[model samples]
Target: MTAFVLVSGPFTGGEVWREVAARLEESGAEVYPATLTGLGERREAGGPDTGLETHIEDVVRLIDGVEGTELVIVGHDYGIHPVLGAADRRPERIARIVYLDAGLPQDGDAAVQLVPDEEVRRRLLDPADRDGGTGWIDPPAADGWQRWGSTAGLSEEALARLTGLASPQPSATFTQPLRLSGALATVPTSGIFCTESGMSIAKLEGLMTLGMPQFKALADPRVSFFDLDTGHWPMLSRPDELAELLLGAAAGEGHRLAAAPAQELPGYLRPFVLDVPEQTRERIGRVDLYLPADPDGAGAAGANPADAAGANPVDAAGANLAGAAGAAGAADTAAAPRPAVLFVHGGPVPETVRPTPRDWTTYVGYGRYAASQGVIGATLDHRLHSLADYPLAAADVAEAVELLRADPRVDGDRIALWFFSGGGPLSADWLSAPPSWLRCLAVTYPILAPLPGWQGVDSRFRPVDALAGAGRLPVVLTRVGLEVTEIAATVEEFVAAAEARGTDLQVIDVPHGHHGFDTVDPTDESRAAVEQAVRSVLGHL
Candidate 1:
């Protein structure tokens, strides 16, 4: 037999778990639904002096009194704090810890820090701003319950029952930092994500790919995940399903996320589809320059001069290539300075990947393809190795642009910037204040806005907002039909903003395409789309 302990979130109590508890009891298991101090029937027993420690003690006492050898503690939302604190002190008694639509907190993380609203978090963290200075945070009214979390799938009666049982929570509970002894690190754990709340197993897996330390830690064998297709309050919205999931969690049965492979390249690094004539390559500082071939075949061999002994070219243009058939005519007229296209590869790419984005087949292919069209092509390796590294990445991009302009072989006054994937946001800086020399801007499958939980992203990184000031700059946007929902939403938002601002934007739709369609899909449509976009960009230049 297993004993299940249910801890409710803020303003609610054991009563909120009644539906789920009944289902669990019917399965011949012991159940204990905890009502913390200052909530539900215990509302009158708490005041300003009540803090997180008091609630933690309440759970610790419950754990001590429960008569069972197999114990599973379930924590929901704000209730996770007391549950974690108690579990740390009684790890031996707990067989599993199930996180029910809750935030992952580390040592010294206060509950208020998890609040998304700026004003609410500020008030909760400041004792002086608490309810009448009594150190109490009032619960939301029945009609205002959505402010807490999504109320989807709940009936009118369920909402009334919830509000009727709600009570004020102590401000200290929100402000007090949670401490851990790391005892529960090895305990088997399950995460039940509420999909309606904008969290799901897929999103968690997506986050893991970003190479964040905290998300990477979730690859532990002891951790499993489940998704609930309902709102945050599953007890009221889907009690039977919640009970069954809890049972499965106790049995250590759920989807396990495999740790990222040690040496496998991510999907974005796949080879590009289009086969274009190779151009001569020159290695500059953090940038790879591809120069077109001379008409007289002076430098027709596609080899890097720098690679040969003492063969440094005076200018980036001195390098040469054998132009493709159609491009020869343009190269014949290239005695004047040549226009340039700088391809910015997208990232948050892990620093561990070999031959970074600049060397990857896709980017190298694009650079060579650009050069074959009678223009200089440049690709760079920027430092967007993590979500928080945006500022540094933006600075690296700025520096690369200057380097491209300084090259005597390239026409600095006729340059176009083409951004891909995560590199799309870097275009916001240029769009906000288009320079006279910047002939055009292009993006393909770009992330125009920050995704959920992209903390510390600068406000200036919003491309949709920047469009209002983009003026008459020619903008080319290539959108795929089957992009991830989060990324697709940002693209739609950017398009709408562009239309609203009457910006000179040209949208190229790939109706049957997916993100990274150029490399992954490889159909004729993909090749055609790539060719069309490249032509449109060059036309602007």
Candidate 2:
């Protein structure tokens, strides 16, 4: 069984989590609801001397008092401070940190710094300073309380109990900067976002736009985000749903995702077949759309689901189409169309091994990863080597693009095209005159021009020849510095040409990595590099 330690925010006591904790306990979790010193029943002990360190000590003591190894630390609002601090101190014992409508802070960032809006800060802090100096901060006015409690959907008596039980917070807690030792980053984390929190989401987005530290902390690859429709207090509004999300996270489901369902995300393989008259194969080619979990409609915020397919895209063959197509089709209909990524795999293999849905296993995982990160992901099956050269393959890409653009669940104008390995040559036409439907181009360890294996091919296969006309489309390239591939010289040529043309080309070099590091090496470095590349591509979308 899992042991959950729930920490409440400023002014609120552990009793506020009574409903949520009760539900967790019913589900067989050993729950410990913690009240920080001076903010709950211990209000008399709080003063100017009670800083963030004191609050952290309070939680560390509770964690030490716990009985089990599967410790999950949960923080709500201001409780994030102590919870994160304690988790940093005991990463060995902690299983994960569940941020429940909480503020995430970086090392050396004070609570005040985490608050992105000046008006709101002034509204909360100015009055506190004027009333009681730095020792304690008083609660907000009546209307302020109403607004904060509005989405909680509490009964009159429950609301009264909440308002009446609120206590003054120690001012030092807000001013004290968090001091971390890189320990917090190692722990698995999940965020249960209250969509009704009018301020936090906007603040986070603003930080991300500015490329700040707090934004990076919240957007770490290890963190999973789940949106709840209720306001700041799900304990009072949607306790059962909150409990289920916590339990699901504790069970290691939806562990590292941008957005996931409160309940289990369904396992479905969906294919979006492209109906273009390229006139080649007997069967119509398809780009499998790897979507995230269907919204449970139990206050689930976003429509992001992950997909399933196996093997490297080049090695995917002999897949059973009949067995994979029809399960849970009804469950996938309501997913709102999102920003998508169109994956173009490399390889100029024999015409007999032309692209197929099953052949895109490796790339499909990338698409699935995109869906997990709140974007729609689709992997295409284009013509192979001798089957059709660059120009024809480019046409196949265009047809697939049209298919994606016509789909209701896709943000057509914001789509990205990712070219892997040998598929890079087919991107020349897109780079020369990028369309409005294209957001950016991501090329990884690519064959930018006709190499030894592809010498004397059609003129269209030479991507380097068209770099001067790459327009202004942003291109993120992942370079493998270790392997000496035949395309190395051509890739360098492409880089120089693209730079001279002022193309927005950003190259990330994996110094000790080989070609296809993501699929071949699959080490921690490989995973990190893949995540970085994935993040870069999604940023354009």
Candidate 3:
């Protein structure tokens, strides 16, 4: 049978791919999500550091069967670490490598240097900082992150089990720079962006405060890109769309969007989804394109994912239209440089949607924010048990990382992550994984206490404890309330605890300040706090 392996990101296991895998199988692709050591139910409580190499071995061993089986290696979020190594070791056995909104090693790169979300990098590597080359992990907090977070959609139950499903990813995973011997250089690449276009409070907070970019960028030669309207947890919010995209891409048919024709319809304006260019006919890749409906089907020659939904290409070949008026056309409006802000919404309840695909939210915003002082922003969609996915929201966040990590405009070295409420715990857990190219960790109103009786939350690795003490990467935090007390009360308590813990913590209590006040009202009391958080990160970068 044709072989495909789905790798897990931080705060997640291979089970998250159940639906996606099933869909692929239905379409005739043998798929399996790799269960690495110390992950999921079969974790490694007492083992060596589960660095990138360890996970790579697990994937390599899983596919040790079937001669000449082309391995379609799919990695999500932190899972990108292993996929890169696997690609290096078994490039010939693998037909293609799909990022699934996951990060990939750039030129002569390491997982630590892949994408530049500095904040996220610190969180993932927190464990490594405290531990001495040993395995230390933070528990997944998918529920806490969604609950107290300003997210727009989610059920209470899904919030409860956020951490329970997650295992402590080895601390070495982040510290051990990924050494791909040139895997991606020769493999076919595809990227998919899950956009959570919502008017939720939590999401709005990320948009304004963090200043994450609205649009993402891509410049790799062997890559293809696409965009979908969903949260960080697309599997839950937009599973069918995600499955369709994933399956089509695997078989080489993905979102083949194109620019629509100019007069095909009345005055209509919309953003064209961005993605990589299509390569071979058998390989499908996506990037949003608004191809106006052509009466003569002029632009139909681009690509399609079959009859399900064909790509509409506008007929801009001949006649003079809009800006495409024949012999030489030019003119446009542009903007400036602001730190790349990845607008990460709190949880399932809401998603932080930005304006477009041209900023910080893409590739962790190091290049823009660090050198150019530009901002990259993004929104949230992936969460537990919101629409379809349960206990997989963390993986979705990882997917977002993958999507933005390779953005052409983003400074992979200075990327960071921002979150509050229900997303706080999840963000903390991710931080516990290992260090990435990221530089700092800015958490507002995070969930420090564990969710009791929440079967969904589990912590095989104590990420916070592992990250505790000296040597741990920098962790900047701000809490609006305590884990169990009033929201404002909890924020105060968290701030205090953060200070005592030696973390760069800041908590605010605005009379009318709630969970997402910062995001919705950028000029509100939380503005200074958010600004401080962003600036503090810049210090290290």
Candidate 4:
């Protein structure tokens, strides 16, 4: 018979897993629900000194008392710390380790490091707020339970029971680093993701495609995934389902995510929809300048035939602008410097992505389409390769702008900056102080604010805060209705701030579109929205 050891998250403890444990026991499995040192029934026995080591010892003692060899250890949220530490020490006696809606922590990771909210983390780190010198962290208020994790599917009665049983967590439990001997590296593992809490197997797979080193280990063949439709506390909201899933997890049966396929061009790098005439591409530093075709119509001066033939347009807006520019006298158009749009691609993209963002089809298509419109189009590769590289990335963008303006073909004073994805925050620097030459600023599906737990991000990169200082700079924003919740919240915050300040802002809504809609959702609505936004931006220029 398989033996199951259940571990609870923060605050409430072994009592919280009673329902799930009962179901497991009824199914003929031996179940042990562990309450760590400062929580649940053990709350009175703990004091300020109870920490991660104390908790790990608590779990180790329970494991030592078990009379069987087939053991499955499950940990949820903060409970994973002790579970992992104990499992590492007793690897030979364990069958499998199940991560029950928890983060995958490594050696030396403290529970405090996993707290996502900056303000809450600050309070936890503050010695003055340590429960009046008791060195205990208070449980969240009943009304603020959602801050810990989504309380979806929990009835009023269940919530009240949870709140009433909560106990203050010892400060040392969060601050003490977990130690691991790395003995359980090859142990079978299963991850239970709570979809409603913003984590899903699909999202993890997408993140893995970015080539982030930390996520690569998840692709191990011994690991599997199971997603629950409810929120974080599945033991409370869906005990029956959680119990059955745990059984299957112990048997090493669950969805196995396929390794990310190797491809020449990933989905994000695919060609855009709208088709248009291409132009010459000039490489200067990290920037790629796409100039309009030569006046004599022999095609662009230095254009690569292969790339030009493959170039596609991103939106119909460029065609309209091109027609308007064509109506003017050729001689006059040829003699004058052209207005420019500097396209900034977004990401804390892993430095491992080949060809970089500038070479991606979306930016290339947009650049070529702008050139087709008789305007100078430019794209550049910046150093936004990590969350902590924002300042360096911002500096790279500033330098790129200067280089674009210095080109004689570009009308320096009439340039606009078009930002995308994570690149949206870079606009904060320009918006905080609108330069005389900046005709317009455009952003699409942007991240206007720092995401939760994004450490080392400079505070200056908040576009929502910068709006108050933006004078009359015309801003065009393209937003998607199906955006990720965290990113969508940032966009809403930006819109609210823009409205409050009466900033010259135009919002183009793509009601059914997703982030990177121009490339991903190639629907008519996405195309039209992109066209409208580009036109508004061109009008400002």
lDDT, candidate 4, 457-483, per-residue tens = 556889999998899999999998888
Return model 3's CA RMSD, one decimal: 20.0
Q: Least accurate stretch of 10 residues (summed lDDT) in model 4?
A: 315-324
Q: All candidates' TM-scores?
A: 0.64, 0.45, 0.42, 0.63
TM-score, candidate number 2: 0.45
The global Cα lDDT (0 to 1) of model 2 is 0.66
Q: Which lDDT tens digits does candidate 3 get at residues 1-541?
A: 5577888666578776676777778878787777777778767442555666787787777767646677777776567777778777777787767765454344333454332233444444466454444455554365434321222333454334444566665666656766655545667666665434222223222322322222112223445555665444454445567767766566665433222333432110121112212211101121111111123443211223222121333232212221221111112111221223343444323234332221112212222222233234433344432211223656655655554444433345665665555455555555555455666666665544332212123342123543453234566665442122423343455455556676644333444443444433334455565556557766555
- Model 4, stretches more than 4 Å misplaced? 41-70, 84-94, 104-110, 113-118, 125-134, 175-187, 195-224, 227-229, 255-261, 268-418, 422-439, 447-472, 478-541
Model 1: how far is 189 from its true place, Å? 5.3
Best-matching candidate per TM-score = 1
lDDT of 3 at 40: 82
Ranking by TM-score: 1, 4, 2, 3
The local distance difference test score of model 4 is 0.79
Weakest lDDT window of 10 consecutive positions for candidate 3: 325-334
Flag the better candidate by TM-score, 1 or 4: 1
Between candidates 3 and 4, name the one with more favorable TM-score: 4
What range of 10 consecutive residues in model 2 has the weakest lDDT sum?
273-282
lDDT of 2 by residue, 226-335 (tens): 76777777787788898888898787655342332325311112221111111111121344666544456342113222213322132234233222322312334465
Candidate 1 wrong stretches, greater than 4 Å:
3-99, 102-115, 118-148, 154-191, 199-225, 236-240, 252-266, 276-342, 347-356, 371-413, 422-426, 449-462, 489-493
Candidates 3 and 4, the one with greater lDDT? 4
The list of candidate 3 runs beyond 4 A from truth reads: 45-48, 66-68, 107-134, 143-162, 197-222, 255-541
